[model samples]
Every structure is written in structure tokens, then in C-alpha cells.
Target chain A: MSGSPGAGRSRIVTWAVVGLCLGLAGALAWAMLDLPAPSTRLPGQVAAQLERSGVEHPVTAVLLNFRGYDTLLEIAVLLLALLGMLAAGVAPRASAPLGASSMLAALARALAPLMVLVAGYLLWAGAFRPGGAFQAGAVLAAAGVLLRLAGFLPAWTRPGAALRMALAAGFALFLAIAALGLTEGALLRYPEPSAGALILAIESGLTFSLGLILAGLFLAGPELPRREDGGGTP
Target chain B: MSLGLFYALLGGGLFALGLAGLILRPHLLAKIIGFNVMGSGAFLVLVGLGSRDGVADPVPQAMVLTGIVVAVAATALALALARRLLELSGDMVLPGERLRPGEDDDADA
Candidate 1:
């Protein structure tokens, strides 16, 4: 492969990349071994402040209360990524039922509602357990994908005004609450009395929107036309 | 070494491997997979290092959760862009590496 000078150069470049990465790995391992202990114990701090953070689960408390601004921006970033996809100009074609298997269709029909219920349960359980908006939203998105695969759901084309509103609602609500927190004292700082309710409200909106956005990421892409040589096989 | 430190070192190894794959792979999809691997490695390192003392740290865990979602979003965007490239060029390769007509581009390493 390296008979030509150009190929030799490519090989040299590959070697250089490999060498650099090996050095990086070595440095990282050395640093990890020699690192000083953290100046502050963050877990202790999080535990100490958990009572006032509005969630029984420390991770949830840290996510939606102590570091809510990050969550808020995260949703915005998701929305922006969806927007970037939409701007790529892959207009979806007219929907046709592609999944012809009766068993798959039947399974999707039976499971979609159950998946929604599971998503809801996860969102509700997040306050005190290992479940939350991200997990719930991912489950919801998976349901949507399953339905799409079963030909129960249509590919997203130009989303109507209602759909657009649904896509943005979570981020808008999050931003509005953050602004409200400014009046309360600082951004995203809820009153201790209503913190739980506020987080619940935010999570609910986020669940719906995040689900739609994640599903849209798959559904928004244009359906590739089938190649003559059977090139687009699944 | 503690379990957390061991995992941290493993994560570092994964990061290096992923970096190598990202740089060496010619296929856009493979590169995307490499990028995800790198992100996973970084997330593992963050959590592993934060918990090296044997106590679970909520802050880093929460941050990793956020990072996972962002990484998903970024992956979606990268895929969308790659699909566009494939559509426009009729090949899933970058412009600089594109082979001329009548030549087998996929034959090289």
C-alpha cells in the first residue's frame, strides 16, 4: 500500500496519529495516578444541601436544582441541533407503509401505549429513584421509532404550527421559569416551598419536548430512494 | 489501584483508541462511531475520577447525564450532515480523499 510516495506519507501520518494518541494515554494515566485529592468534597456538599434541593435523589437534585442552568441550556442545545437538521433541506417524501410484517405491526400497536405509561412512571419516579426526564424521553423516543418501523407512524415532513410549538415548548417553559427565578433572587432558583412542584412541571414539559426532538432526529431525514442494485438494504 | 482509578485508566485507554480510530477511519459513519466512543470514554473518566474516593458523586454523575444528551444531539447533527454529503457527492467520503472516476476508492486502507 505504500509503494508510492503519497501512500508512504499517508502511512507516516497514520503512525504519527497513533504515536500521539499513545503519548496522550500515557500522560492521562500518569496524571490520574499522581493527582492531588480534590480541595472540596463535592459529594459531601451535595448531600448536605440535598434537603433543600427539592428532590430526594441527589442526582436529580443536582440536575434540576443545583445546576438547573445547565439543564436549561441542554434543552436549548437539543432544540438547536434539531433545527440544524431541519435546515439541511431534506424534505420528507409522502408516507407509505413500509413495514409489511403483521406480527411487528401488532406488537407495535400493543406496546406503544405501554411504553408511554413507562415513560410517565419514570418521570414521576425520578424524584427519589434512578429515573428522570432523560430516561423517560429516551423511552418515549424509542417507542416512536418502534412505531415508525412498524409503519404506524409517518415520517415527519414540514411540521405544522402545533408540532413546532410542541418542539419548542419545553425550552420556552424552562427559559420562562429561569426568568421567573431572577425575580425570586437568581436564575433557576425556585422558592423552597414550591421547588418540588416546579421541578415536576419542568420535567413534564421536558419529557414531551425531548421525546419529540429525539424522535424527530430520526424521522426528519429524507427517505433515500431505493437504488437499482439493491444498495439501500437494511 | 482502587476500582474507580482502574476504570479511569481504562477510560483513558478507550479515549486513546477512539482518537486513533477517529483519525484513521475513512468512512464517515466509522468516524462518527469513534467520536461517540471518545465521548463515552470522557464521561467514564469524569465519573470515575470524581468517585475515586469510593463515594458516589452526584455532581459529576449529573454532568455526565447532561453530556450524554448533548452527545446524542451532536451525533444526530453529524449524521444529518453526513447524509447530506452522501446525497450531494454520491459517496460517503470527504472531498479531499475522493477518488477519480474508474478508480476503486474503497480499495485503499
Candidate 2:
């Protein structure tokens, strides 16, 4: 929290911080020096490339075909982080009720189902759009953040079997999908309707699993420790 | 390269700061926070590196994602070790208490 985080970080750390910021700025400048280069395309750019080459939807092409595996492991990382926090014995402190912020609560509650729907839509469109499990899950997780702030959910809940089940769902579903792929060819390869469907199925599990996992990791626990074991922390 | 490189640089700096915190923070709990911050910084760097021009590179991203998980695993293990150390000695060990482990573990909660 201090300039250097220690009791006395010294002039050295102060200089280090300044140096670090400058270095990062320099790197950014260096990267931008070669702007508009063929290798500096954004997500949309790659999609455009695929479209020129006959890909139906560039977004979908990139998400499903280009980096689907990355999407899968993103969920995995969320789960692992959640589990690690629990294992670390970092419990959440009790939260006061949402109290009079009914407006915020109402807004969040109204938004929850809608957000989930959007996440679902994104997952569905991952094969042909900018959205994917990551975006979807982050949205869902934000929903949880909303619910908590609204007093609809507890500040923190102890980790338990339910948590484990929820976290593991993505991995389990992925394995199942991979197995299905193997039935036709190698693991995770779909020889069916198209890449879109494959991505959709995977995205569904990913969205749900990752949303809860990341939310748990971020908001479900207290900065320090907590009381009860596991329960409806809400 | 532009955004990715930028984030990677920022992440790397944050990581070094966190590492210094981990080294300097005397309290056991604060140390954990430092470690978590370091973990986050590293994750950002990994994610940044995973980015590609036009195409999202799945391989590096996947590996980075897995690396985040693995880092969490190590963090958990370290926490467990810390907890045990605290329990045995009734006091949290300071970071610089390396040469004298048993001495500092005696502090009361």
C-alpha cells in the first residue's frame, strides 16, 4: 500500500517504480512504432482475414478454430485459482446487508437473468462473433458481483463439495466433448455440422463454469479470514 | 504486438514490485497478499504474450492459462506450509527469519 509496500521501501524502490513505468511506456512505444504492419492485426483483423479466405464468420473462425483450446484452459485457470484460494485458507469476512440500496439491488437482479442470457448468446455466437466463453463468463461473474452488492448473495461462502462440482463441470463437459470428437477422429475434433456447433457446446459449459469460478475467486472470499465453513453465504 | 507488448511490460513491472513485497512484507498474511499480487501480475504477462496479430494464439494462451493454475497450486502449497508453521509456533514467521526458523515460530496469536 505504500510507495514500495514495505515499512521502508527506500529511494531505491521509488526509483524502481518510476523505472518500471518508463520501461513499460518504452515498450509500448516500440510496439506502436511499426503500426499498421500485417502482423499487428486485432481480433477483428484476423476475422477479416478469415472472411477474405472464405470463412463464413471471422469471429467464429478465430474463436472456435483459431484459439478454442486457449478458451478451454482459461476456464481451467479460473477453476484452479478458485480451488487454490480455498486451499490457502483465505476465507471471506462477513458482509453487511445491502441495506437501502434497493435500487442497485433491483437493477442487479433485473440484470442477472438478462446477463446470463447474453452470456448464453455470446457462447452460442462464439463460432461467428466477438463473444466467447471468456466474455460470457466474465459477464456472469459480474452478475454475481451485482447480486452480492445487492445483498442477494452472501459476501463469502465456505468452499465445499458444491463448489468443487461447479468448478469441475467445465472440465468434465470438455472431456465429454473431446471424447465425442474422438469417436469421429482425434480428441476435440468435430466432423459434424460445423465448428460453430462444436464451439457452442463447449462454450455453454465454459460460460457457466468459468463465470462461477472467477466470481468465487474474486468476490466470494474475504480479504483476510472468515467464520463458518460452507453455506449459502448470502 | 502493440497492446500485448504493452500489457506484458506493465505486468512484468507489477510482478517485480510484488516480488519485492513478498520479500519485504514481514507479516505472514501480508506476504500471501504479495504473493497473490505477484501471481496476478504474472498471469497478465502470460496473457499478453499469448496475444497474436489478427489471430488469437491458442497454444500460448492455453499454456499461460495452465500456468496460472499451476501458480495457484504452488501458492496453495506455500500457504499450507505457512499455516503449519504458524500452528506449530503460535506465531507467524517473518520473511528474514530464514536462518532462525524455530525462534520466530514461538510468537502467540
Candidate 3:
């Protein structure tokens, strides 16, 4: 590949870029040395504030309550990426029937429910443990991926109305809650008494939406026009 | 150096490696992998730097978790784009290669 006449010039440019990147990274590391330790002030305050956030898990409280707007925006970004993909017409194609592969079919059958159970547990444990919506959603997405890899076409592959609703459900619910807060308190300000429940509701919705979005993303199919007869891509 | 600082250095090295790969590799798939490596390195930097004082900071951990999820999404998008490019142009690298008369026909294979 480097036999081309201009390869040396390209090699020189690549090395120059690499050198520049290294210098920048070194500067970053050095600059970070002067900063106060992370557990000093703000993180300590965050730890203290977790109690008031109505969650035992500090990370969960931070992600879904204290700095929920960030989570909201992150979800929007994920959704936006999915939307962009769909708009770009990268749709899933119908794979060959899975009946031929009894082994894969049996694997999907065995693992799918187990993955779902784990996802559920992860979602429920987020209030007090390390798991949360994203983790749970990821597991759920993995299940979808496993099924797809096994030649099963999930309903979301069609991007039908119901699938679209499922995809947007999390963002819609989050915005609705935030809008409600605008009338009572600041945006996304959950009532203190119900903060835990509210967070759980939002997370549950988000998990479902995120799971669908992720699965849809993984199954980037060939574009198929919507069928009036409710038949997905042939 | 302290353990945290050592990890930070490791993160920096990984970032450099990933950056070099991203810049030097001609293949789109390699560039995508490089981007992922870079993202992971940055996450490592965040986690490592934030854990200096014994107590792990949950804030940065949460942020890193979010970053990980977003990175997956970004990688998927990049892969989709690369696949589309390959479908259209029949070459995995960036476009604008002037093909010989018979090369385009060969590319279809």
C-alpha cells in the first residue's frame, strides 16, 4: 500500500499529526496534576446531596435526579442518532428463516428470557445499587441483537407507528414531566415526596425507549416503504 | 506516581495510540475502532483522575456511563455511514479515487 510515490509525504503528515496529538495529550495530563482531587469538595457535596435526591445510590441520584437535564439531553442525542439513521434510509433486510438453525433458535429461546430477567433486575436495583436504565436497556438491546443474529426479525425493524411510539416514549415522558414542573417549580423539579417514584417512572420509560432504539440501531435494515396492510419488509 | 496517576498515564498513552491509529489508518473501519479506543481512553482518564482521593466520585462515574452509551451509538452511526459509503463507492477508504477503465467493473465483484 505504501508503494505509491507520495506515500512518504503522507507518512510524514501522519507522523506530524500523531506528534501534535501526543503533545496535546501530555499537556492535558500535566495540567490535570494541578487540579484538586476529585473527592475533595464538589464530589463530597454530591455524595451529601444524594440523600436529599431520594435515592441511595449516589450515581443513580446524580444521573436521574440531581443532573437529570443532562440525562434528558443524552437520551435526546441517542434518539436523534436513531432518527438520523432512519432518515438516511438504512433499514434492515429480512434475513433467511431461522428454522434451519435449530441450535441458534434454541440459544435465542434460552438466552432471551434470561436477558430480560436480568434487565428487569438491573432496572429495579438502580435505586440502591450500581445498575440503572442504561445498563438495563443495554441488556435488553443485547437480547434483541441476539435474536436478530439468530435470524429473527424484531417488530421494531419495521419502524411502524407503534415502534416509533416506543422509540419516542422516553423523551416524550421526560419532556412532559419537565413541562409539568414548569408550572409548579423549575423544569424537571420533582416533588420531594414523590421524587423517588418519579425517577423510577422516568427511568422505566427510558429503559423501554432506549432498548427499542438500540435494537433498531443494531438492525440497520434496507429501506422499506410502509405497507398499508401492516406487513413489514418482505 | 500514585495508582490513580499511573492509570491516568495509561489513559493518555491509549489516547495517543488511538489518535495515531485514527490519523494514520486509511480504512474507515479502523478509524471507527480508533475513535472508540479514544473514547474509552478518555473515560479511563476521567475515572482514574477522579478516584485520586480514595473515595470514588459518583458524578464522573455517571458521566462516564453516559459517555459509554453515547459512544456505542456514535460507533453504530459511523459504521452505518461507512457501510453506505462502501455500497455507493465500492471502496472502504475515503472517496475520490480515480479508477482505471476496468477497475470500476472489477470493484463490483
Per lDDT, the best of the predicted structures is: 1
Tens digits of per-residue lDDT, candidate 2, A1-234, equal 234445255446546766765566456445544445445435555545554322255544544455556545555655665665565553222334344255765687679899889887876655554566767877888888777665566544475688778778987887677677777777766655564566566668877787777666555444332233322234
Candidate 3 docking classification: acceptable
> What tens digits encode model 3's per-residue C-alpha lDDT throughout A25-136?
8877886677664334657788777777878898999898878888999899999888877666543443343331557667887898999999999999999999999999
- Residue clash pairs of candidate 3: A91-A221, A91-A222, A92-A221, A92-A222
Q: What is the lDDT of residue A180 in candidate 3?
A: 74
lDDT of 3 at A72: 92
**Model 3 chain A poorest 10 in a row by lDDT:** A225-234
Worst 10 residues of 1 chain A by lDDT: A225-234
lDDT of 3 by residue, B63-104 (tens): 998998888888888887887777677767886533333433
DockQ, cand. 1: 0.69
Better of 2 and 3 by DockQ: 3
TM-score of every model versus the real structure: 0.91, 0.58, 0.86
lDDT of 1 by residue, B31-107 (tens): 89999999999998999998899998899999999999999999999998888887777777787764423235553
Among residues 3 or more apart in sequence or in different chains, the pairs in candidate 1 whose N, CA or C atoms overlap within 3 Å are none
DockQ of each two-chain model:
0.69, 0.14, 0.48
